[model samples]
Target: RVIEITLTSPMPDFLRLLAQPEMGIFLDGSGAGPMVRSDESDGQPLLLTPLPPEARGFPAREQWQSRARQVAVSAMPANSAVDAFAAGEVDLVLNGRLSNLPLADTGPLTRGTIRLDAALGVFGLVVRSDDGFLAEPLNRQALSLAVDRSNLLQPFNVGGWQSTSWIVPRELANGAAAQGERWPNLSFEQRRDIARQRVAAWERAEGEELVLRIGLPDGPGSDTLFTQLAGNFTQVGITAVRAGLREGAELELHDRLARFYSPRWFLNQFHCRLELGLCSEEADDLVEQSIVESDAQLKAQFLATAHNQLIDSEIFIPLGAPVRWSLVRGNITGFEENRWGLHPLFPLSQPPT
Candidate 1:
């Protein structure tokens, strides 16, 4: 059986690179034989091996199966793929870029045809610096407090945009013992006011103004997010400017999908060894302990503690789950909506029973 898949990407080479041995998202001793590639000019075909029913992570009633012996892949721009899909040239097209998202709902497309995976992951800015005005913990907390997360995606108006102020997803956390989000009792106005005072105190002490540079990917969605963020910073008496990713911005957007569902998975992203940002060594220690701490109950305790520590550190500003969407014809089979935002290629080629 031969299956053809169209993947829309600005640089599809990135997909092949990430699937390399020991380089994929998960590091759990699982070797990297699983991959998705197809005949390019080299005439080599990449195949996907379906995981057995018992080997699956996310719960599903259907059994996993593969119907494709050969997979053919075509990579093109988002617009081209959208056009092809709308014209019924392809049965499926997977693309996830806010700038290129086709949400106009025209042609044969409707809300029913579009699939947004409720992907579990991070989608916000990580504070990449520990110097200057951000050196103070109070100021960093204030930065988080000032923004109304719900306003960040007002321009895109995408549905089901879950805004968050916590480190771990509420669903995955053993954080039942803990209280709710930071400054829980405070309103958005009150939080902004407090943030303003904190920035004022810092300026008075240093006798200078405070400026923040945010590095965001190019897109209208990013533009809207930055504008809202800039407004929040302005309210707190701090200057906000857009900077290139390599221009040494204090805050860089960190967007990634979780490979599996676990609070520990979320916390490890901030481990000190990764140097992702200003992370706590104590948090790192807790994560290391959770790895071998046999007792499941105690392990949850350790992970919960580590998550709280990182949340308090405010290294990464929590926005919401990463948004991923795909266009599929109604007859397309096996496009299960999983939290990882990954729709495998082999299963997608299966014929509906």
Candidate 2:
């Protein structure tokens, strides 16, 4: 009924994390490893929900299996899933953002069916391109300062959404966070004025007009955020334009959930080799040191130093917490709220108590 794991290094929070929901040891009786698939349904009409693509390899326990016999699984885009859930076609829809937010005036979405998870991870724009005005670190920092992060999620109309300028969420940093906010004392407008000055300096020195090509998704949230960013850039004496994710945009949002709640995990996401674009080698060195350092305080120091180094380099323009949401029918059971943003399919299929 239990399993034991021995770590070569100290992982103080390992036991705490293991005790959380959807966390456990499993016996891969199939021996497929990462190639594993969903639970087998014995020819039942009800559909079983799906785990995230990365989680397909996890074995399905009997308790997590659907109460309905031999159910199926459906995968589709968020919008289509919303439409399907609104009708009686699908039993459950997961990971739909508020951009396709069906009108609250009607439908199951208006009821208590909407579920939002406060996922902890990097949800912000990274400097994807090294060319253009972004070539300079100060210019990148200017862009970070110019954007009104507080308003980026206005399109969703959701509350309690945490907007932050730091890569690691402060509360989750343990003792690793050094300073709280990047600009705690400065007002949003004050931050913009400083950014405008920096941008003006770049324009005057280079004699080249500033342009920021931001890569974004094709959705209402992206539109609102881009428009606000463009306006902010304009006020800061730079022009902002939207670019496709692959269209050589200098900046793009990287919304992701942390596999493990560690500052190192958050810091590794932006490493140069990770393909996250323009990162500090010095910061990478610190992260590497933290990996081998046996001293706990020394490790925390390294992480804190790396975090502040990234902030100073303006490698990523922090937005807010990554959004993970789903519309579950009122009758649905076994869907529990968790920070990891993972909802097992079998649990959603369990009949309502």
Candidate 3:
């Protein structure tokens, strides 16, 4: 009566041994929250069980149980986990990147098993605000216009993926308001021309070629994206070099934005005091206001203002909404897509009668 399942990385792999295949449940250790070993409140179906020393695999293993089911968890790498799911070795795939799965409409595997969740993350580029060449907002805006986001994301072909201009995805609280943009109707060619002009001005002021290194994390779509970005920057007369992540890389790719919820979490990333990556004093003030204001409407208004200020400043170029996809066996039930991109395991992992 084991219910077997596979989950995304950082969860643990040996989980299959503790719980029977049909009785398996997977919990995201990174996001277990209140469900992490709590024996309070409503009688949640799952039971938190301690794994024996041998069951600890390499270091440790955590398990959960219910009358009908038992779950073991382990960290499985993204590619291997997706491969396992496709091979029918696992009943479910939780939190796999869209770019890593075989999701083309015509692919045999994607007939109806792929699920999309509206995740709360931003995939974008970040430039250090203190860099002399990047300090000007116009230079940043030029970089944003150089790459057409829709074209860049077209290869992924994810259904729920949306091109975003602001760091905060629109579905988040009060994030629906348009955060503003530098140019509205300019064609790619027009935008390129403008970017070239801005770069020329920057070069004349600094007396050096406008060269910048862009660091990107290694992943399925990252290499292609880097090549695409380099081409776009070339068209705009800026020398964009694709590099691995380093401290002084002028521009860098951030595929996963703020992982947790809350508008404050999203806005605080760019504040000067935090020193996360980019920094903005004006945006920092707005974030502080949003944090302290007691009134709900005022809080929303303050966030909207902060978002607009950041967007206007062009510190980040939001590439597209973060990609979150899963592959489930046809018979799996009780699955629901939510904006937060969380799927509680207890209800779904109940053993069949």
Leading candidate by TM-score: 2
Worst 10 residues of 2 by lDDT: 30-39
- Candidate with more favorable, higher TM-score: 1 or 3: 1
- In candidate 3, stretches whose alpha carbon ends up further than 4 angstroms from where it belongs are 1-67, 98-108, 170-182, 204-207, 257-262
Candidate 3 per-residue lDDT, tens place, 94-172, comes to: 7766445443233346657878876667778887644766887877888998888768766656665777667776655
Error of 3 at 12 (Å): 34
lDDT tens digits by residue: candidate 1, 106-186 = 566777877778788888788999898789777888888888887777766678888888878877676642455666788
What C-alpha lDDT do the candidate models reach, one value each? Answer: 0.73, 0.73, 0.67
Candidate 1 global TM-score = 0.77
Q: What is the C-alpha RMSD of each candidate to the true structure, in Å?
A: 9.1, 5.8, 11.0
The C-alpha TM-scores of every prediction are: 0.77, 0.81, 0.72
Worst 10 residues of 3 by lDDT: 8-17
